[model samples]
Target: MVIHQNFLPLASSGLPVGKIYLGYLFIRPVHNPETPFKMDVSFIKHWKKRTTLEVGHRGMGNSYTKCAVARENSIHSLNKASERGADYVEFDVQLTKDKIPVIFHDFHVMVSVAKRSPEKDVHQIAVKDLKLDQLRLLHLDHVQHHSNTPLNEQVIKVTGENDEAEDLRPFPTLIEALQNVSTDVGFNVEIKFPMVQEDGINECENYFEHNEFLDRILKDVFLHGGKRRIVFSSFDPDICTMVATKQNKYPVLFLCCGANTRHQVYQDERTRTSLTAVNFAAGCGILGVNFHSEDVLRDHSPITKAKQLGLISFVWGDELNDKTNVEFMKKTVGVDGVIYDRIGETELRSSVFMLEKAKKNELFSKKIPSPVQTPRAGSVHFLNDQPKIPGLNLSQSVNQPHHEWPISSSSRRRSPTVTTEAEKYFAASHGLIQLNQGYLPQQLTTAREV
Candidate 1:
């Protein structure tokens, strides 16, 4: 048996506060105690058999050409994704002219003006040319014409004509996003690197150095990311190499747009084929490759080759908007995970699929191992004194001093009879004062009065 312990601080609640000791034990079953187990040879395909994680694309979903309530890449949309129960939230991160990293998807945004002049008010402006302050003052007109869609149909009215730039939804800084988002959910941060044009010309005249760009994001992640898991991905191979070489904190994934993708076709070696992408990722010691869904649908050979090379595989594209293709990728194609625009809908569908399979297995009396909650016995004492709560596997319990006990689990389980008494004892011992709501010890919060 293997056990892991997490230490967590108690949240603010109605009950009185004192010294709290909590331990969260995760118990795993082992086949053999002495022998070393063989590694999983199937690579990421094994994850497909288990639960398929739902990743929110641009927080819930982004529709630049269509009307949307909460603006894409806003803090509100990020919170909405968390509320909808997304396993991971993916967002684009780019650098401004002033060297500030912000969360935005498009390379440029259209600014609306009250009066039209010869300056071509509808011209698309690059995000890198303007500072954060200048970008904030402009009105965003998120509209783009699709091949099959009409020009007028692409207009999405996001804000009022006279609204100030600050009043509109401004891009969120990297620090703000890292600090404000939920701690439980993971983040898939895509580092935006402009590509060379198909005619072998640079798209942007000036940009940040490769090392400087990668370091800026790394600084924010190390300082504010806390314990949240982060996976770094980018279309530029140089960015992947830099991330892998610079830091070992997070895993790096190479995002590819193969030959069949509708995305801008490039003459570069890496983006032209899926095979090259897998080879490049494996050579650079990258964790995986996020292939365009169209490429995977055309040929699953790249996925199989990646598995053989011990690399993870993921798929994303507009083709995944269809429900049938999502199922096909999960069940037939056997990818590790799929990124979709609609997070809640995909999560619900996957749950239903699992439920149906479980029902079929139940008819044959197949045994399934499900996680059973251990009773609430969360105080710290010496080894001789065990917790009074029943149903605890003391024999398998590994002794650890600091462990995080979930407040949610504590609420569900039976309460400790000594909870109030313990609080009072600690409060008296520490000379704590009764605050507005409850008795708070000086060590808890930094507030002056409470």
Candidate 2:
């Protein structure tokens, strides 16, 4: 025995329906299927499986198609990622010559100038070589895909150029960028290091020694903790080691790049496989490895290997960094998190975490399970090939248009004119509104006045 929700206005004559939800009515079949109980579907809708984990790499990520947005490390990108329902945002951080840490991608940045500073124009300049105020004079040049940037903007660019330093892209200090973001999103900061140093004794000279650099950034991160968040990472084992040892429990990740990547090879190499990288990180007390996706497509065996070794895994880059690839990684590859350039693409990934959080919250609540017969009358259950109860499970699906139900020839012939109070009631409801075409609400004049 089952009951319908109060909202449904059942014809109440020939039908033996259990409940009527939006576009759906659960009806008891003339021939019951099991235990003298059976239900028939009145609606068909698409159902989602479960939530996915979404992450933002270097911020919202680059716009692969459009040139409108290209900066992955900029504040605009981070905010865009937040709007896309990302659980966290990832970027890079490095210490400058003056010992100030800033959010940037590479050890060296390209600045374009038509005439000024021609000696070192359009070349990769070490971030430490420039002071904060001087760095602010350049604008971003490689914002995904674009051209030369103005100095006033000071935005970091990633475009390849051969121009002299007349007008260059400006790079931002980490503190300056953090001042403008929200605390809700987590930050994965990877420290950029050069292949080799200039001096032996001053090997730690221009660069803030690992510990000094880590602490200074930590101070800045905590100061903005009320409005921003921070997690540290680096490709250099020493850098991650320095940070993790200082705080024993703060989140830290080890970044792994392919041996032959960046068009160059490291003089002092770490390992051939990223799985070994994660193992190395664990040995150093680092949290986990942020792996490149090329590792996944080539053979995702390392991911499982990392898991077996008891380390958290996060996938990054164009391979597993996109929407489809991330989904595949979670559904097939089974990583704890994913890092990407676009928040929209990663929304599904973040959903995984959201759903888990929601299910956990339900455990603490005192409630009775609903019966399977009616949605509101009982607990929620998934019955195959049937209509769903409205407002029961609000999956985060977009407004996907569906085809209208086709009318059979017999039903079409029997169609009657709308003569019921239903049409009149809608007309009366419209009449109550003081409608306006543009902005202001207008008062309607009576028919007599017209």
The prediction achieving the highest lDDT against the true structure is: 1
**Tens digits of per-residue lDDT for model 2, 207-306:** 5444455667766665555433355777666556555544432467777764424323333345346766866766765567777777666777777877
Where is model 2 more than 4 Å wrong at Cα?
1-52, 63-70, 112-123, 139-172, 176-179, 196-206, 226-230, 259-263, 345-450
RMSD of each: 21.0, 25.6
lDDT (Cα, tens digit) per residue for candidate 1, span 90-160: 88998888888888887766655454554334555678876887776666665573346543344455443
Which prediction has the highest TM-score against the true structure? 1
Q: What is the lDDT of residue 246 in candidate 1?
A: 55
For model 1, the local distance difference test gives: 0.64
Model 1 earns a TM-score of 0.62
- The global C-alpha lDDT for each of the candidates, from Candidate 1 onward, is 0.64, 0.53
Where does candidate 2 have its weakest 10-residue lDDT segment?
Answer: 376-385
Backbone clashes for every candidate come to 5, 35
